[model samples]
Target chain A: MKFKAFLTDNGVSLLEKRFLPALDKMGRICHLYLTKDHAFFLHNLLNGDGVQSIAQFRKESLFEDYRISSQNDDRIAFTIDLGLLHRALRSSVSVCGHVTTATNRLQVKLVKKLTHNSQQPMPFLTFESKGYKSAVIQDVPISKPLSRVDVVELQSAIDMAQDLPQTLVQGPDLHQLQSFVDRLKHVGDLLHITITQYGDLHLQLLNTLTTLGVEFRKLPVVGVQAHVPSGDQNMTAQSRTKYAVEKGEALSVQVSLKHFAKSLQCHLTKPDCAFYGITPLASCLTVIFQFFIPGTRQTDKSISLHCRLPVLDPGSA
Target chain B: MSSSEADPDIPDLVCQLDNVQGMVDALSSVRWKRHQDSVLELSEHGIVVIVEESGCLQAKVYLKKELFVSYEYRAEGRPRFGVSLGVFVDCLNTFSVSGRSSSIEICYPGPDMQLLLKSVDTPDACIYAEIRTKVPDTISWDYNFEPAGSTPLSFTVKSAALKEAIDDLEWPGSSIQIVLQPDPPCVQFRGEGHGDLQIDFMYYANTDLLIAFQCDRLVSYRYKYKFLRATTSNMPGSVIKDNRGSKLTIGRGGMLKVQHLVSVARPSTQHPHIDSAAYQQPSRIAYIEFFVKPEVDEEPVNDA
Candidate 1:
């Protein structure tokens, strides 16, 4: 297996300052999955507990002169410490001043290191930056690459997690939501999230003594439209109209408040907006963080981040 | 819909407050401990929250009906309940957005007799909370606080300065002696322990600092330094920011009463509709009083 890439200036900044730091808040260690066209940072995919987060970036958006060769369809997946990776990137940028410039070059390569005391060599992701006066090189250790069967299972988990809920509603402002959730954290251990077809999102915390709730109304819907059968369009439309006259029935799921607050830390990335999705009877709630062009509403497809927060059992709360 | 509208089960009390921070400030002043329980009493005229500590210190926060934008009380008699002071204050803190003001509607006896609070002004979002309240037991002590004589010994000082003076005396002693002299028309705070520290507030020295003064004779009483510190330590920021004055009165039986006024009015611009007709009217205020019993053994000095 061989993998080498030169990071662009923008890529270094985005990874060092935004993406990696955000992932670091989610978990201590994460799997770095590299393929021909994309790279993914995944947390808690194999673990049955805790929140799972996936951050994806298009290869071209972050790397130049990228090359990879492996027996498993040119794909490489290995676990690494998020903090170490972030520190390495930060040191490289600070040391080289203007990385990727004519005189300063930054390259990331996967190599094996031989230690005097050990017979077997250990794999390391090395950051090598050269400047006019000084050169900085940092080595971050990595777990052994996953076997083919393990890679297939990991890919399946990713696909399953990517499944979208039937209904998705935009979330409230990050600052407001953060403050609200923080208050809820003090009141209860579990949070109940309710979403409706009419663009309302309700968050509630309950205890023996008090029940606290917050509702965001008329939020824009971004997912699938309410299902209406084509054959019985007229009758269904009439019935739907009647149902609309009544209050919209809401779908709710209970999740740990601690896990929910941890996922909200993605606000540090300063995403344009966040969307929430909950599938009925599902064991997790989906949160997708969308980044947009600086001044426009158009989404920046180059990067994406989403999290799956495990829902507590209905009887648990 | 207004609570006045006829319904099968009308709530015992419903009130709307425009400035949540003002209410938060009033309640937080008496929240000296993390798990203190406060008794909430509702009357047609206003609401009173009473907190006491081991029968030595008692605080009362009076939020009159005028302080609310709307008040509806239909209960036949006064209803009282007990709630955790810290939880209630922390919950109210969430309703207050820093830059903008939001009105909150408070309702009592929520189906389960819980206190219900809902944010009313925001069109896009609403925050609702229900805090469980217990049936209150009879209060520990009720000091009638009758005046010592025809002219009560009382003085008003700038809250900021008073807070500073009390805080500065922390290191000097465990007990503070307060003396009011009619001859010089000044109040003296004396702390004695490892060292002695005396702070004098002369009535005529600085009108801005010492706003009011009244004394009949030389009356001095010593109080626990910790109890006196509680009164000034948590004086809300708005009181200091608005340059309000706090009145310290020595009632009969060596009882100390500290009175503070907190404005409960949101900016007129935020409630133009309500303030349009009577914009010149002064904003309503909430009254907070802390009653502390003086040290038992030290007889107060009285010059007849």
Candidate 2:
């Protein structure tokens, strides 16, 4: 029974780029769920600001070489301190490393470059010795993996979160979005975001003292058009045009500015992105953010990050 | 002020600040967290800006006539305008964002005039903002401020020390109990939350921390910690601000006024040797007065 995983530069880069932010959104506490096929990370955000996020990557897509015996049936999972993981990655000189799972500990092998030269400063020696690279392995202890019931619940939640209907605000380019966020930065944490039937997305901020709102009217959107909520109508049909508020009334959700700002951060990474469908659940408002960055070669980076913003009032519906 | 340009409207007046940017920056530093709008009063004696917080607090930042290079106003009586502080600050900081320090000229045409701000550096575009001229509710700038009976207790402490005392308080605290005494262990701060936090600072008549300490009677007053925080958070932080520190003056009527000292940076021009490394840029003394009214129901615990 042989099991070894070679982490490539691409895998490390993916973690550096995407998974790290996901960790931040999830309040630096998340589970690294790994299988033979791919790696899945998930976390339920804390604070009244309900945000849940999951990042998944196919093993073959990110890793250059990964070998696992068919005899192992159970998927390896561990609760990782995201901040500590980031620190370890940063401290590792090579950044790229391999991970081989053991019974109780997860082994991480980071290739660190050690420079050996004359301890003297020589002006003539423009070219020094090519640094010697050595692999330094650090084994991190694994925490308790999720039980069967927890895994089932996590899967169903992810499934229910998939294909959510949302109305994306249109017209304003990335620059406008950045300015809008910057302008509203001083306002309190609770951001009241509203979408009307006429395709106006209004970001409002209010506290016990003052109220301020900015409206983005006739925003561009995907193919889905705003539809009215029919009396005694199909729930599925209503969800299709998720952005639609009641007639002459706006459907508004108060979300944590910090979490919402994290999703908007996606716009910074990729200019062409959409704030997708929103599903207001009992506990959180599930918002899907889809990013499509043009790839250099064959496969482009297209990923959907789901952020569950906690509903201030569960009885509002 | 340059006596250069011409515009319409009678009783028109204009002025340029020595460091116009200084005036702009001073006006912008006003953190009136309570209200979205503040009243800006313009007279021949410069501009007086006032903002109220949570109804209980009123703040005034006075940019006097002396600060300007040429102050002139021909308008009948002192014309006042209510302006959104955030928007006004945004307009003032536009040139700063463009990486150019600007020379500003403020123009007032008449009572019903829109405030016009022209930048010499960015001559291509100037900001013209509508002055909310006739809002009566926004004109609560003047407060009697006279002590009712007793000589109001006064003390001066380093902004850094006061900041530390405030920070030492545990969260969820509602009231800040300030104990001022004339005897030993002169001043003490008490904050009540889940538990009580007490910080005692010995008072000296003249020191870096305590510039002035005058408490004729031992008086203790409790103020809303939140209101105090709203003002202290925007204080001229001890680091960047000049030597003059913050002063706390508690009135007999329980008006807790904290004057945070601010040194407005002025561009160097008086010195001939621009190349001199030690030629320090001039700084004008300014202060933001945060007057927080105490809870009417709470009685002062007098140790007199």
Candidate 3:
């Protein structure tokens, strides 16, 4: 193995015709008088990221006898310390230099064989220097793996989303409960089977009279009326009339049960009936009316109902 | 050098040199070529220059001066203005010593009539006889007009004298160029003729709506002609004039025929009745007239 570098026609003209001769004649004097890093700087600029440091090149064992010249056309020739350069060429870090060495060494040898076998000079440079042959190779480092910080940040985002509300319930219990409510009407009477909701009942329940054939009504709501004065205008001059009705007639009894009491409670989530109008009954009921069934303690289910009976007859009163 | 001791021949030499210098100055003054906004070129001869005054006020003032030439002939046709150019009598002075004397009284040549009347100091009401061409025995002159009040604008002509002057006038070989100034937006033209000489009194004017008149239509060559701009007082912004202070060149005689008119009508109410009689006379027109005379048989010069 050896350190090798090949120059193109353009590179050869710049170095062999212009720079190298100046270098050979002046050497250390040239380095001192001119910019200290001429050759290294030019090589680095031309090759970009591949050239070695100037200190490394100067320390080579065969630094003194290097050959540099313009051969006929625009070709350039340069010799390097083969033994020391071979060590650098064998190293993984010196791949660029290794590639130059390998390609030029083979090219030079092929040219030699062709020239020796033929009756003419081959169309390639025949180097006479001792240290100018090595292999060339691509030189780039491998990419590194992702860092821990990135992985940690990704996992932390996932953990931060865990407390969000459930988007989907995953069980058979909800289906079973829905089926129970749908089939509740078929349950036996002894169980006092009643279907309701977690709010007020809007309809009256049927009551059976075991002793009498006639059924009476019960008021679920009370009504009270008071005279209210006009807010504006001359009410004092306006005529006012008071009278006993021409004849008292019987009035129909009806109930106005609150249909949204529990719904209001649930929506407000308050212990008091602040969201509902709780009214007292004007007539006493002969039968009890179940307003609503609170949700089951363990299952959270609710129901509502209403019942009715006759108030006392006037004669009885 | 003493003044009296100087060579007598030196003064003679200086005098001869002065004469040569004078000859050069004279040659230069005899400008055979000229360029102007309005030019009537005659080969190897002076041109008849018509300077279209730009503003309405200026044109009105210029028109009052004999800068305006009016010719009235009661043919079986409409009234119009026409102008033609003959050899300016002033030009004859150059050849007077060469044994050629005019046998006719070239009294008021076109340009002289225009210049004298325009530059004259006569009051608007006072009419002076600014003689044009008194062709010794060819044509007579006349001055006629109806005054605003009682008096009449009268013109008298001697028929016999006019006939004699007409005969003595020698046109030999000459060309005439008539510039048609149409009223701002009037393009009315009526042409009638039996053969080579057709007469048309076309209404034309400068862009100024005020300066307009009926003139003889002699446009044969198609040319792009420019007229003074009509002042657009009603246009809200600064007045926009297509040919504001610029000469319009009718492309190579192509635009010689005038058909379209661009005009700015005066506001009727403000000056109502003030100029009604003058402005609204149906066949009314205002125009400046001039003529050009080029040597006959000489080809017209193509404008460079």
What C-alpha lDDT do the candidate models reach, one value each?
A: 0.83, 0.55, 0.20
B147-202 per-residue lDDT for model 2 (tens digits): 63566678888777777677666464788888888886377878877887787777
Please give the distance, in angstroms, between residue B118's alpha carbon in candidate 1 and its true position after superposition: 1.3
Off by over 4 Å in 1: A70-73, A97-99, A112-123, A141-153, A222-249, A293-296, A315-317, B1-8, B183-185, B192-197, B202-208, B268-282, B298-304
Per-prediction DockQ comes to: 0.44, 0.03, 0.00
True-contact fraction per candidate equals 0.65, 0.00, 0.00
RMSD (Cα, Å) of model 3:
47.3
Model 3 regions lying over 4 Å from their true place: A1-317, B1-62, B65-266, B282-285, B294-304
Residue runs of model 2 more than 4 Å from their true location after superposition:
A1-3, A45-49, A67-74, A92-133, A170-186, A197-199, A226-250, A262-277, A280-287, A293-302, A314-317, B1-24, B27-47, B51-59, B62-304
Cand. 2 TM to true fold: 0.50
Note the residue pairs that clash in candidate 2: A50-A310, A165-A277, A166-A277, A170-A219, A170-A220
Error of 3 at A107 (Å): 70
Predicted candidate 1 versus true structure: per-residue lDDT over A1-317, tens digit per residue: 98999998878978887888888999879999999999999999987698999999999888988999999999999999999999998889888874578667688999999978879999999999987788988999999999998888888899988888777899989888987888777677888777766666777787876777787867888765454323422232223323432443445678899999999999988899999988655557899999997789999999999999998864221
lDDT of 1 at B203: 85
lDDT of 3 by residue, B124-221 (tens): 11111122222121111111212222321111112222122222221211222323332332322122222122222222322342133332222222
Q: Cα deviation of A279 in candidate 3 (Å)?
A: 90
Tens-digit lDDT track for model 3 on A155-220? 343233222111111111222222322222121111111001111111111122000000111112
For candidate 3, the per-residue lDDT at B80 reads: 17
Q: Which candidate should be chosen as best, given TM-score against the real structure? A: 1
Between candidates 1 and 2, the TM-score winner: 1
